[model samples]
Target: MNDIRLYLFQSGSQLCKVHDIKMNQGCGQDMEIPVPWFLLMHPKGNVVIDGGLAAEGLADPRGYWGDAIDAYRPRMRPEQGCVAQLATLGLSPRDIRYVALSHLHCDHSGAVGRFPDAVHLVQRREYEYAFAPDWFAAGAYARKDFDRAGLRWQFLDGEAGQPFDLYGDGALQAVFTPGHTLGHQSFLVTLRNSGTMILAGDAVYTLDHWNETALPGLLASAVDAVRSVQKLRALAERSGATLVPGHDPEAWRRFRLAPGYYD
Candidate 1:
């Protein structure tokens, strides 16, 4: 039997309103939401889904983002550092064997430098976009941290239909669920005691978004995003796997949280 146990680590949480942006669901009003990033642990090994915004960026505004990053100042905080949270659980950065990123967004890839020894897994197309961003806007990718850490990287180049099995035993799988970004992906983790849990990265940011069939303002392609959500919802229904959204406030309350960890 696979003795797998899962842990939900709240690397960080942010409060933001929909009206903060120019696009407000076409209703000209704002909605309050809690944004959260998480980490998953298994008996076989620990895998960090997405690294939350780093403390450095939250501390000195002039250091990381001079003017372009000022828009997010109100919602970001240093108290939710992922590295520090890991220490609270008696697990160091070295304890993580794999760092599976949903995409290369600045918020999701902030603390990647914390785990230097782990193999950083990402889709090939996503890495390509991060390296050469001329096709889209520039500075969308943060490459400095990965370069600074001298971390080893692994690229998933499989076709969209087939899922990439990280452990080769069907215990942990990375599913290609692109939309918000070109190479965006989600993870389906099978636990021995808890069945299957699907980490729906930014593909489905919140359950409300899924229910309403609404797309976030920042999207590579709205059509693709909708399709990815349909696929995720179908998979979750067929497999009976608990779908965890990337930024759902109720995720911590609905699912089990790691001891001493708070959202």
Candidate 2:
């Protein structure tokens, strides 16, 4: 049997102008971007990547997101949280052995607290930046999502060229892809039947961004973003891996969701 399987879950969707995701274009165009998370089922353990909206955000947007709620209108339901979605797959937070966050953005790490037993992996800079006093001043990184006590935090050192092997069999690997955030990362999963798949977690919002080199609506460094895209492009081309974007509505529709999986 294949040692691992992958499932896609639609945690929530947000309404934002096209410019909010792709810079200098789609200024007046309104679109709904789908927020997705992945569940990697391995023989040894389960890995959760980029947990989406938590029950709190779906409960109260203004209370959780503040004034930014108007610009990035996040529409979520309590049932859409990671825990609830996992339950649909006959799993729960307790089943997850590791939670690898792409970045500490509010939308991505919202449900992290649900998996306190899992080893949370994040880049050193991303962890520090998320806790920096000025970090919350921008209101992008929500404290409630990550400040939970008793949660196991594991910092991944990119400077040492550490590519985290999720199951120690090289089926899943973490790829450093920083641009949208200072220390963001993507995932590369080598499946038995589906071949190689690179889950581009906000590294490239949509294929448009990957194709046209259009910078994301919000970026920490444009230069870094372009470089990251180039790296992912090269990796995909060389390995013939399918690139799974972070928040592309069109791309999201193509994936087979939980209960149904790619093995």
Candidate 3:
């Protein structure tokens, strides 16, 4: 039996324009989607994947996120951050052994600093780009979230057969699937009885993108993004793994939330 377990936390939610979620669709409509984070427990160590919005935002959204809040306004409960969620299990940031970030976008990277003791895994290009993003790309990243002091970082460049297995055990693998943002990635987790699953971060915003029905509203490279979706979808099909979209309201509900887990 596998000793790995996965916990899904609903950190909070975000309100954005439908145009920002689906291309050429729902222009005037509003879309509210869950902001989620994952915790993986294995006999080897514990890991956190993009632990949602910062708890500070609950007190001061504008002060914390600044103008970025205008585009993706957030709504969060008090107990919905990395620290609070981990606390439920008698854990803390120091308890995390690794933090495998999909990318360093604001919403995704907000809780990074909390796990100072863990080795934070980031893509090399993603690290450089998020640090010095172009004018158009700057808003998506908030440096305060990641540019803190004394956090250990291990950079992964997209290499051939690029899924970097976390423990050399097929349990948690960070798959190189860029596109929505340069160096963006997805994850493949192998559960004992639940089977393998793909957590498609921004690389696949919703099922529409996975189905080729729509292009993501935000794309660093449309070509790269399209190829990524195809790659992830095909992998899921071949391996009989469930492909979870990054921010799909309807789809997100299908999963078992935290306080619950997939083992």
- Order of the predicted models by TM-score, top scorer first: 3, 2, 1
Question: How would you encode candidate 1's per-residue C-alpha lDDT over 94-194 as one tens digit per residue?
Answer: 88988888888766786577786788888988888777765443444556544464778899974458999887777778888877788899988776666
**TM-score attained by model 3:** 0.97
**Tens digit of lDDT per residue, candidate 3, span 199-238?**
9989989999988999998889999999998889788988
TM-score, every prediction: 0.85, 0.95, 0.97
Error of 3 at 199 (Å): 0.6
Judged by lDDT, which candidate is best?
Answer: 3
Clashing pairs for model 1 are 19-30
C-alpha lDDT of all candidate models, in order: 0.69, 0.84, 0.87
Which model scores highest in TM-score?
3
Off by over 4 Å in 3: none
Measured with C-alpha atoms, the lDDT of residue 11 in candidate 2 is: 73
lDDT of 2 by residue, 1-263 (tens): 28689888887789989998888887589989998889889888888988887678766778887776777788788888889888988886789898989989887896587875799988888888888835423567777888888888888876566677767787888888888888899999889899889999999999987896578888788888888899889989989999999998998888888778888
